[model samples]
Target: MHAPALALGALFSATAAIAHLACIAIGAPAYRVMGAGERMARAAQAGRLQPALVTLAVAAMLSAWAGYAVSGAGVVGPWPFTRPALVLITVLYLARGLAFALLKPLFPGNSATFWWISSGLCLLIGLVHLYGLLAAP
Candidate 1:
């Protein structure tokens, strides 16, 4: 059970990271061509992808938490930073997702540095979770 959970967590984290990176890359071109207003309009019109991405992001965070909980239970010493860091990362991911959803309208254009930076952060957080999984017992 533990092994499977860890594997699943790693998989989720990696997938989330990759997906966000892709979004940032692809969205860049879209922003360049259409401008933020058009891009936001497209996102609003399409509807499906935004919600799906949000769902996946949330799932990734949840899986990371589950993995940490399982692995932490087995350890004897205090994992002072690991658990809190996981929580913080999860919050960051969630906050970014929410911002993307709500502020999609204000996105400015494909050149939006904010989007790129946020996406990169998402990938970094995912990598952090992956590192945690590797370090776990």
Candidate 2:
């Protein structure tokens, strides 16, 4: 009925950490799996993507904790910030996911289909997280 706080949180957390690690040293082949286009691949080749992805990974870790807290598992003492924060996080994620697909000018060189599918997955993840957050007792 609700989110698997421990499991899903771990999933998110591990995903972030590993993605960061991949960016740290795996190079362009990894970015290819992430659907990076020519320009992005250039960036990776030039070694610009790693720092950016690593920075994002830090935020992703925070998001994982937010997901856990909103699930009502491992919630810290009586904080009033959970509901609104989760709402905002969910909205932002949904926006980011959907916008990537709809905005034609974005991520030039990558196939629209890839971005669309990836964005759809992001939206699905966000929605599932929202469902658990809203369902929390």
Could you say which candidate leads in lDDT? 2
Error at 87, model 2, angstroms: 1.0
Work out the TM-score per prediction: 0.32, 0.68
Write down the lDDT that model 2 would get: 0.60
Best by TM-score: 2
Q: What lDDT would each prediction earn against the true structure? A: 0.51, 0.60
Error of 1 at 54 (Å): 21
Backbone clashes for every candidate come to: 3, 0
Query: Could you tell me the lDDT of residue 32 within candidate 1?
Result: 36
- Model 1 off-target regions past 4 Å? 1-9, 19-80, 110-137
TM-score, predicted candidate 2 vs. hidden true structure: 0.68
Stretches of candidate 2 above 4 Å error?
1-10, 13-17, 49-72, 75-80
Could you give me the TM-score of model 1 versus the true structure? Answer: 0.32
Q: Can you write out model 1's per-residue Cα lDDT over 1-137, one digit (the tens) per residue?
A: 13443444445555644554444446534433423345553664565476346534755665555455445434333345656655565566556644664665554454456566656655555554445545655
